[model samples]
Target: MLNSINTNPGALLALQNLNATNTELTTTQSRINTGKKIANAKDNGAIWSMAKMQSASSSSLNAVKDSLQRGQSTIDVALAAGDTITDLLMKMKEKALAASDTSLNSTSLKALKADFDSLRDQITKAAENAKFNGVSLVAGSAKPLVFLANADGGNFTVNAQTLGLQGLGLSTTGTTFTTAAEAGSMISKMTAALLTATNKLSALGTASTGLDTHLTFIGKLQDSLDAGVGNLVDADLAKESAKLQSLQTKQQLGVQALSIANQSPQSILSLFKG
Candidate 1:
């Protein structure tokens, strides 16, 4: 080989190796500082894209959980009202039976009617007041209460049936009793009304239970998705720490190698002196 004075190939190769080690050191430090292996798409395109999509979906599922919780509250209120109304109906039944007797006069019948009216009014108020977040599941809106059950708004839904005085057969416009004979005829109607209210309570109870189960499931699902995203995007700190120490040590060796290569041309000077 012809020894060239102008250029040293060994020194150039050592410099290149040093620069490569420096670049690797920078990357390892960045991973340590940020705690993310793929901080951006530039780091790893496919992994970054998948992580972004999963993160957005997790965010959307959180919103759905909120909606489901609100819906559950509304259903709970309606259920409470229905249960109260059912108890009131039982009281009304007692009053109706007492007034249906021939032994009761006009005054007693009128008093019984007043007590019955009071119970009916209370039932109306209960139904009307059963609202959550401005939504009355038991009154006004006949439409079923719909809640998002999934991350995507289009996919799944939970529905609760609407209930009210009319739905419960406790509407004030019906079954008025003026006389003892009329009161006697209304006993069966009151019993039927109580049955209807009990049934409505059952339906609400079933729906509330379903919402609770779904909420639990959704919570676990979110946890899994988060873990998955973290696995894909989060840096392995232990591994990165080891890599950083290795890179730093390697960089020092690279610098020493380059210095030795630069000194090699000095050996050629010894040949000229001899």
Candidate 2:
């Protein structure tokens, strides 16, 4: 090979190889540091875009889960209140049956009526106080509770159930048991009210179960989406670690080769001296 002091082809070739090795080294280091094979759109545009979209979907599912949780809590409150009302109605029925006995004195009938009225008032109080986050399902409200069901703008609804005195076909002014006839009339009303409250409580229980099921499904769906994104972009750290060491070794060797090439022009001086 002909060599000259003004231009050294070997050194230029060595420099080019070294620059290539440096570029590869930078890429490997970035993979190790970021723990992602495709950290940005430039790395792999199609895969990066897909992973980003899936990540956004996973994030949106978080809101859906939260809405379901709130709905579940509201239903839970209503169920608890409904159960209390059911128990109160059962006790009121017992009082009305006792008051209906013609053998009972006036004083005894009045006492039973007082007890029945107190229990009826408690039922109204329970229904009114069954609120969660300003929402009450059994308080005679007409609004239904709606919750996000998925990332695709879907929703779940729980229709409101009124459990008030008027809603249960009872008198808001309280029932009277002043005579055997009045007490007998109250027994029929109590039976109907008990049935109505039980049916509404059952409906609320079903809604609660549905919310729980969907919440579980949302959690699993989010996990699957996150795993999909990871599969698309997450780096294999073990492979990157090995490649990093290899590239670093290559970089050092490249530098040494360039130094040797730069010294080759000095060999031509030895020929002149001899």
Candidate 3:
């Protein structure tokens, strides 16, 4: 049974080869244009998920670091104001000692009293106005600020301890001192006040140090998160360069293969002439 259908085997093979070459060319073009092997979720699901998680972690850690820095600044301002108040109180004590000297004239003593009163008022004013980011740490107004490290808790919370000056009888005016001895008596009452202020300053320093330590740990966590994110999504120039070279080579080979496939139908002409 000799059938007379004119079907060329080379032409069919050429069409198949051409389709394969075209497919490879398309894939190489996609990789080159997009600059990513795994451009979509369907490409590599696990890597995509990991990259997303790393990105999210980096964002959260960055926010936490910003908050910690602001907290540190707030603590610094409060500590400085506290120390200033203590210094002013020390100066007032020196003036009070001068006022109690019997050799000083009455006018001189009254002048010293006026200066002492002004210094006391300034101390009170400083305490009342000492605020950071609108949150007061002195004058017994602000709530205790807390910082927690992890989800399970068990982190440090720095409390704003009182300086214990509630009964010092240290006021600007209204109380009369009859003599130098009476004025001198007030120093004993003020002794506890000065000591308490000094102690509070020390406590503030300790608390500030603790905050700084915690912030340092937070910064380390942020650095780790940044590294993880970079590892996940950042472009590897060395690997990318190699892949690009391979893709370019494959593209050239595909073009050559396609040209040969297109020329395969010409071979049928030779068979026809024979």
Candidate 4:
């Protein structure tokens, strides 16, 4: 090769190779630092874009999970209240049945009537208090409970179930049990109310079960989406570590090559020596 002091082609070629090696080293170091191969748009535009979109979807699912959790809590409260109402109705039925006995004295009848009235009042209280976040399913609220079910704007709804005294077909006026005939008439009403309360309880229980199932599904869906994003952008640390070692070695060799090329001009000085 022709050597010149002003312009050394070997040095330029060596410098170019060293610069390329340095660039690769920078990229490998970045991958190691961030633990992601495609940390930004510049890494791989199409893959980064897709990963970002999926990441957004995964983040949105967090809100959906929150909504579903709220819905599940509300349903749980309603289910508890419905179960209480059902138990109260059963006790009221017992009172009514005892009061219906013709052989019961006036004092016994009065005691049973008082117990029945107390149980009926407790049912109303339970229904009214069955609320979560200002939403009650059994307190005669007309609005249905709705929750986000997916990332696509889907929703799951649990219709409100009115369980008040009037809603259960129970008389607002306390049943009269002053006489045998009056006590006997209350037995049928109590039976009907028990049936209504039980049915409502069953419905609320089913809704709660459905909410639990859906929440589990949402959790799994979020996990799957996050895994998908990871597959697209996450760096393999072992692979990167090996690559970093190789690039570092190459960089050292490139620097040595450039140093050798820079010294080549000294050989021409030796040729002109006296």
lDDT of 2 at 136: 94
Off by over 4 Å in 3: 1-40, 147-156, 162-178
Count of clashes, each model: 1, 0, 0, 0
TM-score of each predicted structure versus truth: 0.89, 0.96, 0.79, 0.96
lDDT of each: 0.82, 0.90, 0.65, 0.86
User: Can you write out model 1's per-residue Cα lDDT over 1-274, one digit (the tens) per residue?
Assistant: 5577789898999999999999988888999999999999999999999999999888888988998888778887888877787888888888889889999888989999899878878877877788887787677464577788898674333444444557766557675678888778768878998888787678778888988998898899999999999999889999999999999999999999999988888888888884
Candidate 2's TM-score: 0.96
What is the per-residue lDDT of model 3 for residues 237-270, given as tens digits with 9 covering 90 to 100? 5566666577667657656765765565565567
lDDT of 4 by residue, 1-274 (tens): 7778999999999999999999999988998899898999999999999999999999999999999899888888887887888788778777877887889888888888888788878877888888899898889654787899888889999988888887798754865467767767887887888788778778878888988899898899889989999999888999999998999999999999999999999889888989
TM-score of 3: 0.79
lDDT at position 220, candidate 1: 91
> What RMSD does each model have against the real structure?
2.3, 1.4, 4.2, 1.3
